[model samples]
Target: MGNKILVVDDEENIVKLVSYNLEQEGYEIITANEGKEALAKIEQENPDLMILDLMLPKVDGFDICRKVRKDGNTNNLPIIILSAKEEEIDKILGLELGADDYVTKPFSPRELIARVKAVLRRVDYTADEEKQEVLKTGAVELDLKKHQVRINDKEINLTPKEFELLSILIKHPGQVFSRDNLLGEIWDYNYHGDTRTVDVHVRRLRKKISEYSEQKHIITVRGVGYKFKED
Candidate 1:
């Protein structure tokens, strides 16, 4: 079966455009006009990934994200927030709410596709036999072979990008990886489109790990990249 993607948006045109682009790339598309319907589809369809709209009707994107995270069944599902809210706070709030990624409106179809492909590629589940590497930092645990990561034994349902980003840091422990290096390793992007993309993902990653530590799990280097902190 083609990868199923649930698109939640109040804009019909945006849905049509995104659905069309995603379909062209051989992905299965499921759509919703509001957050309420989006949650219903999320429960009924269990899409591999979701494209959520922040300014959704009725329930709103943040509410939907918070709800999904509350439900254990759909908690691990990857969410990409697609909204016109380009402000830094809006972006941070979305990521903090457990979204896997965020894309502002007026996005280029090509860039959007690239971003989608990048997210999907990271989430492509590894085979059962591949679950052999176990890396841990403090109370957090990452089993590379099992594709499982947990904090205090409570599994953190991280998207592929988050997994890769964390794995890179945890495997090394103290080595700080610059943002550019992280972009290359995680997103495989060579250019400097938005360096903040790495920063946003790092913030989300840190939040996911912080459930185990009150201080922080990932440490930031003021002028450089990021590193994993065991203490």
Candidate 2:
């Protein structure tokens, strides 16, 4: 069997549908009907990834995502939000809450499976990158193996997502990557509906790094997305 995936949704048919498809892909599937159950299973099963629904009973997807990201143990766990809400704001909120991807209701099973594979691949890619030697630019340094960042030799803490975003930009300094490009690179897939996610992470990343480093390394290219300054 492949990696275990937790499927959380109040709808029995949706759960069954997704589980059936993912199982066909050789993944082990776990199911939860409500938010609380999802949280419990997340702790007990330690699923490799999660397919979460927004309007769950007992607890909501937003709270679940928030709690998961806040917890050090599961902060980096990959999450994909599967919701009926097609509103742009809902998509942005889901991403801002740390969801790796968002899929709306009535989605194609094939596309969902593709997204699952993509997210899993992204996780593998990030893990492989972590083995590389430390990366530095000016006074800022990133030790991927150690999962540490330092400015002026003083260590700083960053969320897993934040670190990944920074590492990608620093790895390709002076190259302008649009929001869609970044979503594909960092989230492991292109999320055309939720480009605001990139904006949110960029804003947070900018604020955190600014506190310790005087260099305005992350810059917006106006009509373009963002880039690391060359000099």
The best candidate by TM-score is 2
lDDT of 1 at 42: 95
Question: Where in model 2 is the C-alpha error above 4 Å?
Answer: 146-161, 187-194, 207-215
Give the C-alpha miss distance for residue 85 in model 1, angstroms: 1.5
RMSD of each candidate relative to the true structure: 2.6, 2.5
* Model 1 agreement with the true structure over 113-216: per-residue lDDT tens digits: 78777777766643242558687766888898877888887887775567788888888888989988887777653432567778887877777667766767
TM-score of each: 0.86, 0.87
Output the worst ten-in-a-row residue range by lDDT, candidate 1. Answer: 122-131
Give the C-alpha miss distance for residue 7 in model 2, angstroms: 0.6
Candidate 2 clashing pairs? none
